[model samples]
Target: MVLEQLEQAVCPQLDYDYDLAIVGGGIVGLTLACALQDPGLRVAVIEAKQHSVAASKGQAYAVHQLAARIFQGIGVWAKMLPNIAQYRRVRLSDADYPGIVEFQTADLGTDVIGYVAEHHALLAPLQEFMQGCSNISYLCPVEVVKTQYQPDCMEISVSMNGELQTIRTKLLVAADGARSRIRNAAGIKTRGWQYWQSCIVAFVKPEKSHNDTAYERFWSSGPFAILPLPGNRCRIVWTAPHEEAKALLALDDVQFLQELQHRYGDQMGKLELEGDRFMFPVQLMQSDRYVLPRLALIGDAAHCCHPVGGQGLNLGVRDAAALAQVLQNAHKNNQDIGSIQILQQYEHWRKRENLAILGFTDLLDRVFSNDWLPLVVVRRLGLWMLRRIPVFRVYALQLMIGLRGRIPQLAQK
Candidate 1:
């Protein structure tokens, strides 16, 4: 009743349109909405499902130092602090190598390498916080049926509670996920292929504390990762060849647990699988274009990378931060935020950045995902060299945290 009255009271005013209309209510969309909120502009988020009722679940995200800083700028760090699980170090090992290379915060002169947290926990507080921001309006549980772009604005028609409504906004942001409907509507093409592997994720209880450390073990078949959670529980993202994954997924609880132990070894001690296992097919996809006219894509909508470095969510956060900075800069300059010129600036800055990272990461994935003798020797030697050289280590750290050069404005904030 209250929502109905609120919508009714504001419907007339909404007819005047908004400065920005964000499609998708995920973290990227909401973050963009909050970032663009101000007295001089109006922003609206059109979500296909109620925030609390959305069934889509994301994998565990590693909050890199840069991404954490961006979250702080967006006023979500403090709210997310209590729920985060600190990972003070990372240990990377190759099956062919006798020595493991460890990345520790103490060595890097920082408090922690990064953080790992469930996706849902991070978004809960963000949703609650958005309620008090007056400049943003959320129209949830509504499906966007059609969208038309004019020279000056994009008109979107959505069906809310069985009625069709149209919204005209200067800029349209598509923060939708990898299978982005908005991207398709804009005729953007994505180029990539699915990996013949599947990742199985499960929660397990370790016999000993992880001590805020994460581990990544690369085997011939694939990489097995054990990321520490808040308590004794650990999250596992184990990848395997398609046939192996199918066989593993078909195993019973006891059989599955045994396989996990055999593959993971006794690093943290005995592991008791705690949650039901889930599998996701791996893919490496990148869009041909990130922006077009008054529309821009962010997050998984723009690119999807391998999860080897745990950089997927970090990359998405960077996208949101960068695009937000671009829009904010235009707003400060008294320029239209939705103008094609303004949107192109965001595309220019983000395209090269994401492309470079994507290429580098793709190379890493190919190099590490195999068991060829020559490639194994080279990678093991490279790891040894990286561990011995301080300058090389720092460079690697910078690349891992997405802090290689001048930090983005939103990240600095």
Candidate 2:
């Protein structure tokens, strides 16, 4: 009802200014819009594609224990609960080396270690939630062509239904993907490199039950992860060299299944491909600064890392929660949400966490992706020690489940 009014409340010829304007309607952007819902604030979401069009773009996503809690707080988890498939434990094994590490929910006295859901599953529900919130204006089928960051407000020119429209907002959030136009427009530089590897993703069904266990097997090529999905289905993420990824994508289903069997064994029995294979290049990108004047970067706009750990989206969720709380409080206090101070506070809270997770994933990639004898020995020894060390076990479990450190209020259980 509120969104319907937002569509007709103000004429496009008049001012369409908003308190907050978020670019990109992916999970991160939509979830941020959902978090920013307040009767006191007017928020606008700009996206180039419709929800159905965007839904078909990405592969599955793993929602860690912490990410799920964040969703629960945002009020969309209840709508998404029926769509998720829980992974009770996660196992990491080295195919060439004799090291296997397992993280189980039982050890932490939790019901689930994490969960896997298609990227669309979360986004669709979140978009629905946003549409119903009166404070949010769903500006869809729009392409942002011009962005101007002013001293007090940011102006955005977008083409909606082929007709150009201009909107202004006090705070502009770049929830756009890796190549963020908003971040670039803000002149926030980033430093990172693309890895030589690419990942091939596909949905498959094992002949036997998966038993809701997620597996990450490291080989000389790269990391091969099998994430559990509901109904005895699994999603395979095989990160190999660019050449190897090309070969895997070109292979026939029989050959692909045979290769997977060779690497993963018959733990889940025969593997049958259930969907078309897709491949994407992997990279590590972190913005130099997460905020600039009236602009803030969140999700892929701020940082992006390898998918070997499934922490990408969860990291963005934490950012949204922290930023939303900061902005909500600032609005209540009659302070500017776009002020450097408030944005800096959000950046201060999330910068370390983002960099630390990036470093951790990078370390895992370097240690496990190479076949150097000395490094392999050291890595194996570390894993071996972790298994026997009680204190370390507890810590590792907490880290994977996203319960370590000072959690944001919205993400806390």
Candidate 1 regions exceeding 4 Å error are 1-16, 55-58
Candidate 1 lDDT over 327-389, as tens digits, reads 877767666676666777778887778777777767777788897889988998889887898
Q: Give the winner by lDDT.
A: 2
What is the C-alpha local distance difference test score of each model? 0.80, 0.84
Compose the digit string of candidate 2's lDDT tens values, residues 294-374: 899999999999998888888888888888888888778667787777788899989888888888888888899998999
Clashes of each: 0, 0
Clashes of 2: 0
Q: TM-score for each prediction?
A: 0.93, 0.94
